[model samples]
Target: MIKILKYTEYLYLAVAIASIYKIITLWGVAQQETYIFIFFAVISIAMFLFRRNYRRKFEKRKQDNQN
Candidate 1:
């Protein structure tokens, strides 16, 4: 489960990167709508943040249990 959560964090980061790339490329063409990419980037960022927090909490709990 922890490994899966870690994978998801990376996935979100990847999505964010892809969204940024889309915005950059589209900006050059000036022919594509960017709201969808922006929305995806926002969602990806949020998910990554949430997962980071959750992972930290889990690590804290594990440390407490060990101590």
Candidate 2:
């Protein structure tokens, strides 16, 4: 479970990247829809970065506790 949580960072990162690509592809086709995708992409990036930072801090605390 801990391992899965750790790896979810990668999943979020992937989704962010995919969202960016989708936005790029939709540039000319759907300007209005792009705004929603952009919002999601930005949120995904923030979540991915925050999760990675939080996980690192958690791991450090866990290691300190074990020692």
For candidate 2, what's the RMSD?
1.0
Q: Which pairs of residues clash in candidate 2, taking residues 3 or more apart in a chain or in different chains? A: none
Which lDDT tens digits does candidate 1 get at residues 1-67? 7889889998999999999899878875664467778888999999999998999899889899999
For 1-67, candidate 2 gives per-residue lDDT tens digits of 5588778988888888998998999989999988988988999899999988998898889999999
The per-residue C-alpha lDDT of model 1 at residue 43 equals 96
What is the C-alpha local distance difference test score of each model?
Answer: 0.88, 0.89
TM-scores across all candidates?
Answer: 0.83, 0.91
RMSD of 1: 1.8
Report the alpha-carbon TM-score of model 2 versus the true structure. Answer: 0.91
Candidate 1 runs further than 4 Å off: 28-32
